[model samples]
Target: MAGPGAYAAVWEPGRQNVTRYRLTPRGWPEGRRLRLAILSDLHVGSLHVPLSRVSELVAATNALAPDLTLLLGDFVASRARIASDPSLADLATELARLQARDGVFAVLGNHDWWHDEPTQQLRQGPTQVGLALERVGIPVLENKAVRLDTAGGPLWLAGLGDQIAFLSRGRRPRGIDDLAGTMAQITDDEAPVIMMAHEPDVFARMPDRVTLTLSGHTHGGQVRFLGWAPIVPSRYGNRYAYGHVREAGRDLVVSGGIGTSQLPIRFGIPPEIVLIELG
Candidate 1:
């Protein structure tokens, strides 16, 4: 059985709890290799959050020496957590410690929506985290895209805001305003386009233009059984549990994520960090 934040279980001394995944996409543009490390569903201040565990996760990500680092949202569990604790500030600092060459980019997760604060106040949430990254010169991307002019010419990294959070504002983007439309702005001639969506469920409507989509909202079922995860609240069934899946011709990799939410317990699934190597 896996807990709400469990990704996978492996046995190793002093590192018995670390989970890692390598994603190699063949047919990618030649000369451009983007090693992206994805950390998702952190749920920083929830009941079962093990700050020490996240620290190790961060250390693991840095050890990979990726070209870019991406934080896939759910930084905190709820609005109350964001507003009440300055300790989250410490967690934000720890996350800021992740290193990347191109830069570290982040998106807002549903947990960041807890207090319903205005953008001014909302800015504080990521700011606390972003400022930490900025000190190291990493930029966070939210519902936006950044073009990386690499040796391969140019590549674009796009990020979409949290779906549940966007819906709560009664201003959810539909049709053209959705992610598919935003992805359209990236020209195909550029290097392959990659998207960072918080939840794997959002990929259903993702445009075919995207070569690979990275997300982490399911926590790999948090509690799973023999390839069957029972607690997946996703619209896509257990298919979203911790691995690679093809949908409508696009590739999606959903990380199991680090930290727990609602409750802290893991049986089969443990926390994990994903390393994706783009060929």
Candidate 2:
């Protein structure tokens, strides 16, 4: 009776899981392995994802014992029809708890760009969410790339600006992302690259040098049924809507993510944090 309704409305939306994957990408070093914890679409302060939930997920991510943790933006719940949500500062406190051996890095999502009127108006500078994360020691990369020395080898981490950043408002829609610029920042030619992009739609254009691409924006339909999400925010529909995809020797992983977008309801997909073991 009440069980089914509760499962759909509150229980499913409130739960969190760690979805794991192990991949040996084309450019990954032969004997080296990197355990990465990837969190996306946090949409913190949404209906189910409160400060408490964020704290819990941070604890959960740390427990995964990841060598690296990556956040793929949308930390703010700009579109959720909630009465109230936690402040950006409060959300940062919990996110700061996330630990990774190589440190945690992040990229902005469309919602993050859409949420900030000032940034959207100026079409530059860090958003409120970016400042919040950076203050807590989490570096927010927008059209930037950085190199990290790892046991496996030197790994290049590249992150792009939100693709649909200027989708809304009266302004004509366009992406602020500069894939070419971000890729050019990698001075080293041989190191394997791992790119964090908010939308999986960018994977198609990635160069052959990248070892793996990680993304989250669809929220696994945020209301999936039978493993398929009918409504994905991407241009390609369900093609890159979710899960690990291998195309033309490039590896891409799209996280279902932990929070809802437009509506605060999740049915089959639930909420999740993605963990990838890449070598």
Most lDDT-accurate candidate: 2
Cα lDDT for residue 143, model 2? 91
- Tens digits of lDDT, candidate 1, 1-279: 443233322221113243455444533675566677888877766554557766877888888888888898777764454454446557777887888877788876666554335533443344344444456555656667778875344788898866665322465422112575566667666467788888777777776667888888787877778878888858778877777887666789988787666656555666677877776
Model 2 per-residue lDDT tens digits across residues 1-279? 688777877889888888989999997888998999999998887778778888889999999989889999999885732557788888888899988888899998988888788876887767888999999899998999999997566899899988888755686567889999999899977899999999999998989988899999988777777777889888888888889999999999999999887777788887888888876
Residue 18 alpha-carbon offset, candidate 2, angstroms: 1.1
Weakest 10 consecutive residues of candidate 1 by summed lDDT = 7-16
For model 1, the stretches where C-alpha displacement exceeds 4 angstroms are 1-27, 47-52, 82-88, 115-137, 151-153, 166-177
The all-Cα superposition gives candidate 2 an RMSD in Å to the true structure of: 2.0
lDDT of each: 0.67, 0.86
RMSD, model 1, all Cα superposed?
A: 4.9
- How many clashes (backbone atoms < 3 Å, residues ≥3 apart in a chain or on different chains) does model 2 have? 0
TM-score of 2: 0.94
Q: List the residue pairs that clash in candidate 2.
A: none
